[model samples]
Target chain A: MMEKVAQMIAVTGAQAVAHAMRQIEPDVVAAYPITPQTPIVEYFAKFVADGVVKTEMIPVESEHSAMSAVVGAAAAGARAMTATSANGLALMHEIVYIAASTRLPVVMPVVNRALSGPINIHCDHSDTMAERDSGWIQFYVEDAQEAYDLTILSVRLAEHEHVRLPVMVNQDGFIISHGVEPVSFLPDDVVKKFVGELKPIYPLLDTEHPVTYGPLDLYDYYFEHKRQQIEAMKNVEKVFPEVAQEFFKISGRKYSFVEPYKLDDAEHVMVALGSTNGTVKYTVDKMREEGCKVGLLKIWMFRPFPKDEIQRYLTGRKSVVVLDRSASFGAEAPLYEAVKSSLYESASRPLLSSFIYGLGGRGIAIEDVEEAFEKSISGELVTDYEYYLGLRE
Target chain B: MAEQKGWKDIPIGGTIVEAGSAREYKTGDWRVLRPVYDRSKCIDCMMCWFYCPDLAIIQEDAVMKGIDYYYCKGCGICASVCPKSAIEMKPETDFAEEG
Candidate 1:
């Protein structure tokens, strides 16, 4: 068990993440500044300039090159990381798959924001939900404390032997990104020891035994290479909880694939991700005090789905309402799709429905969640699914 | 047919087995025309050796040892760069006929 005492500091989520980066002292952090995500790199830049962290900060022209540079750096056996939001994440979409397909465990913290057409960006899940299939392990944080902790934890999880996949530690844009909260920070020595020296599996820079990455893998082996990535994701199912348990030994804060709150006898359970869970938890507690059997399951590890665990939680619930911040055009929303698919194979299932809420940084109050839970249990909301919450229609 | 390797047989990240494995994947089959060398008229300028795009022209001790047809794509750069006209582009059918 790690015995180092943590320093309690009040800082924004971006600063918390930047502090974690300073502690990890990654070999390279190539990033381009965009709103919300800008502060993460900005704070780290101050660290680099002040000699607080010796990280080689590469200020690239675009998020594409930031991801590309980090991919190259990680390929050459350096622990690399970066930060981005909505359009920036979209810009890096191509190389994002390359980073995962190449199996370089470079950590990136995505400050979740709305993908723009009207150009409104306060906080939403549209950016990350769009890249749901992009082969990165996503850990959605509900607060600045999680943003700080997961930023450091992502390094350890990404570099694990069983799961050599890139990890995206996600926080809400402007909301958690700019909101200051009291976060207990682990010591630099503890972090350094935890995220030990990276032993790259097949480093391209090894002169004695050279290797290639991102080759033109045609049909002859393209399917097989993809299968390897799928297997790596599957390995996360087993590896993440183990790592989180070990991390808890030192930090005293346990994390899991999915965080359950009062699901033991919940008749109405709301499933969501990111900072919305904070509001849902508060609402659930308030409802429980008034004798409502409502609960919540805030998913942290989004990729690898945690299908069995999710099915285990919502299987026999009386009413299940999934909240997705981003909508899927003509289809079910991303989170709804994932949760529905997980329960599709289960023997017992809940009366399920989905709500599209918090798009373009729309405000979600305790009343909004309460209304959804009430409608879910009462079966009063018709159309059964995709109930638009807080919409003007 | 998928390649014979099981999931474990494949390397983690599409890593090639040996250094310069591209040499093993013969591109000669892609050739429509082939470069034929005349050692008699050769002044050994090494231009053909230097100009061969596929590194097809083999050089031993600074002397051109003829083209390695196995990996030659027959781009005709070797024939074009030869000042002595010692290298000529001929139909690949000639080699097929000879075989």
Candidate 2:
């Protein structure tokens, strides 16, 4: 007799994300449903009603209140989860930063979508980019498989004592969130074992010993508290890989916070994050076949800014191109600039390039990256903070 | 103002510290100005005490006081009912230093 396993289940990426949440068996989930992010919360709420998953699902009145509730719940030592999209995440901005710095280890699944200017809702990086400074460790997933895998690893990573920051797992709205695909879900026992038993944190609403978590820090204590957040982030660069190794050992699907594809002796490489890296990697493999030296560096973890991994990957490269789906307004895209600074200390140099592509849900193709490589080599390289690629010329 | 008599002296809650800390407290976040008074206001004919929503205004030994801060948002109902000009709306920001 063989045990039935969900080796490959055909489900929407939203379902995969939601199922993963149940597998983590969070203690509390408070979320207000918005378009492109509604189904996930709905599915989880149903999970609660059916007793399929033992969790408290609080349907909130508004996104802002949902965030506030999660912060308070998490501070009270609950394993909390929430899902939201563009404007929803925008509504959660203030608390999002607090959630991270408070080190409550709240995990959120962000369905990446475009911010409304003229009003459009599809796949884009605008939402998560708006939260780039929110101190949450962001993992951009291109497909349902990665979504399921990333969601599980998030709990493992965030709960690390040294890396107690909230994490955001980003999946492109409508693309990955709505797109149905066969995903591989780890068994409940397997996931439970991997996630381990959640330990109750002290002073977490323990009236026996009242303790403050998110206090209004005076100017004198504010910087020190902020340093504490940064110091925890610094530990993640060391702890993430170790945790990931344990994940891979059990699940057999491995991911580094930073993945460099075909960079092994390449003269130039394109560095980008999120689901878009799939296209870049395919293009890099094709270019390699033609004896071209172009490669791809895919960023799996955007928050901790894997400087050491980046420095190691870009060491011997001649040129590097970074593509961002969101614009930074006054400066270059956050990831592009972070990579440049990380490489600055490296003696093995590469002429770094920057491109702000796919803003406002615009489509990007393999040709866009191929074109970027051409312009970079011909010295038509972008001299500005960022260049708009695949946008109306 | 005589229609509104004794305002404070309302046993908002049996609290010693917060009740006496300030005789009057005002919170108008509810889109209406409300005033609460200290316990020294007398002539409690139960006018202001009867006009309250939760009946939060009460008379203690012939003196009227409002609800304590714990349960009292300082809606000023007690002050509104006081015909004696004993109740005045005090802003919550007055105690911002305490926060």
Candidate 3:
């Protein structure tokens, strides 16, 4: 039974990421340490020490500097990247905006963790939620294989000239980030051939040429600056799948901006992102076996929010309940809002709903997901509504 | 399969090099490099004027400032280290080449 669960490799989650960092061969990785997330950076430091990877890894004063230094290195035309989670991601929030706004194609792994106002750090979307609008392409993974594969694919997708956007490949902090599973890492040549070379839109250090980046703006110029950022962001919808298609030819694990699991001919569905998608998918199958017409949506690309594909996936569906691990504070969950907007333009849109199920690393069991689906089907739960599913007394 | 070629091997024979590469400008060719100033955001800040690094920032009034990137490196330090996010970096794509 355990063998079918993917042979357990005698390696920690941090070591898995370390192995990935070596495979990606980033020219510069500058990351500081924190719980669970520390081992990833530490393992890369070990790679630099053991001469396992040919790269420059910087030890910075804080996560802010870690992000700041990578921005500087990437702007100077190096294949640069880093890693962080929760509070660390929040610390680098200012520069994360700069990295994407400047169009430096840096890729980083965000081990999902809860934010700290009350000091909790066990796999929540707070860290990622805070940075959702920061202009990076966010992807969530279900397991170590994805953590390994997406890390490689991220460099390719982020660096694609058409996209040229930073990407955050997130794995749930304790669940996937700390889990050990056998990952058949593609050979170095295969990854190199797949990811290809780095050609920045404008690299700063070229002696024969010079370019300006990350400009400031006033009201007169600010609007257009942001417009251009939007324009660059809008390009990703077409840009992502071309790279993904090529990656599919090699890796065999194909992905879209949003992944649809068993959605066809279905009347009920649950849209989810990140690792929980796996659990929900299994639950969907179980519910389907019980004669329920339900499906699952596993969203991989969170930014540039694959709106059209999302609605197209739901074209024939009857109802959708978005299961979000993060909340928008005083409003609907981000996933729920995105799903609503995607269906906004659809002619045959379904009754859509929002469920803010997980917060502060609290669990949203599969049973809760099934219960939400049952409620949506029988009209016991209103579609034009939001519910915090797992609130504890 | 997509073709992979180095920029060096691209043989870009007719690539247009910017005028800054050569020092000469034809009379009607050089587009005036504009220094967009922020009047409301400006605090009589000479930081842009003083730290022109290339001395591109000009002090028109006692407080108003400007940049002449005829020598500006596009380094953006003036706009970046600015007290307020005021000044901007725009490329002079139409600058005339001088030889």
Candidate 4:
């Protein structure tokens, strides 16, 4: 195989995702404008107006309609997608579950924002974390490049024969969505070939072979149908690596459920998801230079909750701190809860601690991450209750 | 009755692969009041046929025929729409002993 040189361009995470969408040229894009995620649809719409792609862009009245339109289009066997942010995602909650339950491979790029009460338009995992059980495969990205790559990769993953489930590719609001970075783009032809055409199963448009979707499933079959979704999610875990390997051939960027940085032989570790991983990586490097044995574990696939991999990575560590960007309100933080549960059966379990940070977009400075690591190493971080990072006492 | 399928046997996503499979449901058993057509007073205006939600008002060559009890949920719309009062809502118990 010849060496593949990607076309590198600097753009915001939203534009990087839009560039990916433009390359895929899905049959349908139905979206409503919301902060952070708005530029993604705007750029795609511009591509449509400029005839850069032949996508049928639907200007939806609300995020609910946006998701509903994509669901309908996918049901009709069209490659379909939508984008939304915090409140917009909250509005689309209904159809979001339907899209997954109906087994439509609709790809959505969600700009992670804090679910509102104070109406903040900043970065937090509250939006997608609230949807952990919605049955869609979730991929949280660290940078513009991952956001761009996963948006393309999610297409193949969602439409895979055994995994006919929707995928939500999440990037932090403003932090990644609006932050510009150098994102390398594969040639349009490479992406087009990689994603390929969506061969939908039991499409509603197949008039000759008529099929019913979203039928009234009550007590008789609802439980069984849910069980099928469970099986499909299991298939996602199996197929994710296969699809990621295929993507590696083209983009040359390897991906996995969990990404560990300087983890081997480390005594202390900090685990997180989304863009916070970047901060943790920087802090890990800084701490390592000071002769501290610390590392970071970045969770890429949060839906399947890579329990085994997480357990394998942090098992023998002296201590581990889970940085959760969202709180569960009267419970352990979301990612913290998952990590603790994943390590519950491990005989060599690390001293685990939950550090809630970045709620409503409170910035997590390098010093804040350093503090968490230092506290974990010094045995000062509490395992009994949650600790707040960058929170004023 | 057709055999009920386990999760593995049925298509994924609760999709009904066979179109119009509702025909097998036999909703006629849900009826408490049945509509009986009186051919002697029939006007054949097609009102009953036009108003029947379940398409249970049988028609032959565009001429009104008797109701199809297999699908009719015993809704009185057909009887109420019959201009000549040719259709009457009779208690399903009236012929409980008969088919």
Candidate 5:
């Protein structure tokens, strides 16, 4: 297939994702507007109103209903999608699990935000982190360009024959969602050919060849059904790269489960996901200028947690600092725990410490990252307890 | 009993590929009370046929025949809706060996 000249446009992360959705032209979009994520569906809604895309847009009452509607549409063999933020994701919690277990390939872009307690609308990983075990293929993007690219890539990944599972493409709430950046697009026709049409195995709408979905599965068969889902997730780990390779051919960007930056022969490394990876990269570059042996590992795909690849990159490093945006209450932070587990089988592993930072959108400046890096290199970072970054004493 | 399928043999996502496969599961075994029809007292109102939730009422050319005990779960909707009391709900124990 011949590649088309990429269209360069300056847009917020939410609008970039919306542009991707418009190009894909999903059959149905059932969404309820929430902060940060609202602009995505809002822009798509405008596309429907202006006759740019012939999508059946359903303005739902709640996030719960929004996901439920998407599930229904997907079951009927339609390519369906939705978007939400922190509290909205929490509201859709139940159906979110259903969408995956039922094996419907629903693509949803989640604008990462802090979960509510005192109720602040800001950037954090609390929302998606809470859903880490919900059986969805999750991708965390660093900028608007990646967000746009991953949103398009997620559709193909979710609908792959061997991996018919839902996908969540995450971007930082207001930091990336509302922040304007230059994003390149792969012309509408190229994207449409790349995504292709969803060919559902047994759609509920195929009346002539009817199939029963969401049946009351009992003890006799429930375990077996869950086993099938496990196998499907395993397929995602394999199929993701193939789909991404095809995407790379059409668009010049490549994606993978973990993206390592300047880790060759580095002694100290910082591990993180989402937009914080961008900051960490800047910090690594600044530290390297002063001859500091520092690098960064950015986990793009969190679920089906890329253990072997992560272990490979961090194996010989002297020390590794994991920055988690969400706290796991009494336990080690989510990403920190995963990194710890991944390294358990390695013959030689880095001395790892967990740092909880930027909860409720507390900004982590370059100085803050430099401070963490300096402490890790000096072996002063605590391994037993998590250090809090940007927390007031 | 049909051979119980292993996880690999079953369809992905627990989807039942065979449409209307519920017909294969004989639910009449669940009936604790059976509805007995008395043809002589029948008013032919077809109320019993219309009210049978299980579609257990056998009918041909709009004419009521005996109930199909194969699927009747004995909800007794047929007996309750009989305008002339043509159908009676009888305890399963009363007809000891009958299916």
Candidate 6:
């Protein structure tokens, strides 16, 4: 496959995602608008109206209906996609599990934002983190470029033969979704060939070969069916990097389940996900100049939790701190629990601690990360399970 | 009859093998009372056939034939919908003597 020279263009994460959707030109897009993610579907809707793509753009009444429509279309053997944010994603909660359990590979882009109570619209991982166990293959992107690339790759990964499960590409709400950055766009023909044609395993619409979905399963088979989903997610961990390698050939960029930065020979490490990695990189570099052995581990895919890769990176480190953007209330935050469990049996495990930061889009400065790393390395700090990094008093 | 499958052998996404497969699983065991039809008084109005929750009423070419007891949960919908009072609900134990 002869590749076209990728063109660099300035666009926000949402716009870049829409451009990828336009290029892929799926058969159906059923989505409702929400903060930060609204522009993604809005731009794709424009592409549909302008006849640039032949996708059937459904302006659904709600996020629940949007996911329901996508599930129906995908089961009928059509390539389908959607987009949503915090509250909208919460509304689609029930059907999200249906999409996974039914094994429909519907691709969606989720703009990460704080879940509402006092109603603040800003960047946080609360929404996607809350849905960790819903059984979807999840990917968190650091910036607009990664957001665009991963959005295109998710379609292929979701439709892969081994992993016929729904996929969500996540980017932080305003930090990445609304921020404009220079993104390298692949040619339409290249993306078309890369995604190829979706081959649905058992299409309900094929009258000649009919199949039923979402049937009642009592104790006789419910557990067995859930085991199938577990097997599918296991396939995701093996299949993700392979798809990324194929993507790396077309474009010059490579991606993995996790990205480790300056971990070698570092005594202290901070693990986080999404757009925070961009800031963490600068903080790590500055701390390195001062002779502090500090590093950062940026997690790209969260759902299958990538335990093996995490152990490989943090093996020799002295102290590790996990930064979570969402609170788990009565328990330690989600990422902290995952990291702790992964290292629980390792021979040379680091002293682990959890720090909850950026709730409701609270600012996390480099000093906060540096302070956490400093306290973690000092050995005088009490082994408190979890700390709120930037909370006032 | 549809070939029976173990829980593991069933299709991945709860797909039933054939259309209208409720016949394969005899649900009559769930019944405490069974519907008895007095066919001589039956008008063949087909109301019971249409309103049966179990679709247990056997009809051929719009003519009421009989009830398929295999799937009839004895819900008594046929007795309730029969305008002629031709269908009656009887205790399931009473049918043991006839069997």
Candidate with best DockQ: 4
DockQ of the two-chain complex in candidate 2:
0.03
- Superposed model 1: Cα runs more than 4 Å off: A1-4, A382-384, B1-6, B29-69, B72-99
lDDT of 6 at A179: 90
lDDT of 5 by residue, A1-393 (tens): 114567788899999999999999999999999997989988999999999899999998999999999999999999999999999999999999999989999999999999998898998899998898888999999999999999999999999999899999999998999999988888888899999989998899998888888998887789998998889889987999999999999998999999999999689999999999999999999999999999999999999899988888999889999999999988999999999999999999788999889999999999999999999888887765589998989
lDDT of 6 by residue, A161-232 (tens): 888889999999988888999999998888999999999888888888877788887765788888888888
**Best of the two (2, 5) by DockQ:** 5
Per-candidate TM-score, first chain only? 0.97, 0.94, 0.93, 0.98, 0.98, 0.97
Per-candidate DockQ vs. reference: 0.48, 0.03, 0.04, 0.65, 0.63, 0.37
Candidate 6 chain A: 10-residue stretch with minimal lDDT: A1-10
Relative to the true structure, how large is the alpha-carbon lDDT of every model?
Answer: 0.88, 0.77, 0.77, 0.90, 0.91, 0.88
TM-score for candidate 6, residues paired by index:
0.89
lDDT of candidate 3 over A1-393, digit per residue (tens): 012122335565557777777877888999998876888988788778988788998889899999999999998889998999899999999999988777778999999888887898887887888898998989888777878778888888888766677999888898787777677656667777777778855566775776555543334344544555576678878777887888778777787787788887779888887888888888888898998988988888888788888878886678888888887888778888888987877889888888887677778788888889889778787867987777865
Q: Give the worst 10-residue stretch by lDDT in candidate 1 chain A.
A: A376-385
Cα RMSD, each candidate: 3.7, 9.6, 11.0, 3.8, 4.1, 3.6
Of 1 and 2, the candidate ranking higher by lDDT: 1
Q: Is candidate 1 or candidate 5 better by DockQ?
A: 5
| Model 2 spans > 4 angstroms off | A1-6, A203-205, A377-379, A382-385, B1-99
Q: For candidate 3, lDDT tens digit of each residue in B1-99?
A: 123334333211112224252233222223334345677787876777767666667676766556554555666778776788678655555333431
Off by over 4 Å in 4: A1-5, B28-99
**Which model scores highest in lDDT?**
5
What is the i-RMS of every prediction?
1.5, 17.0, 12.3, 0.9, 0.8, 2.4
Q: Candidate 6, overall lDDT?
A: 0.88
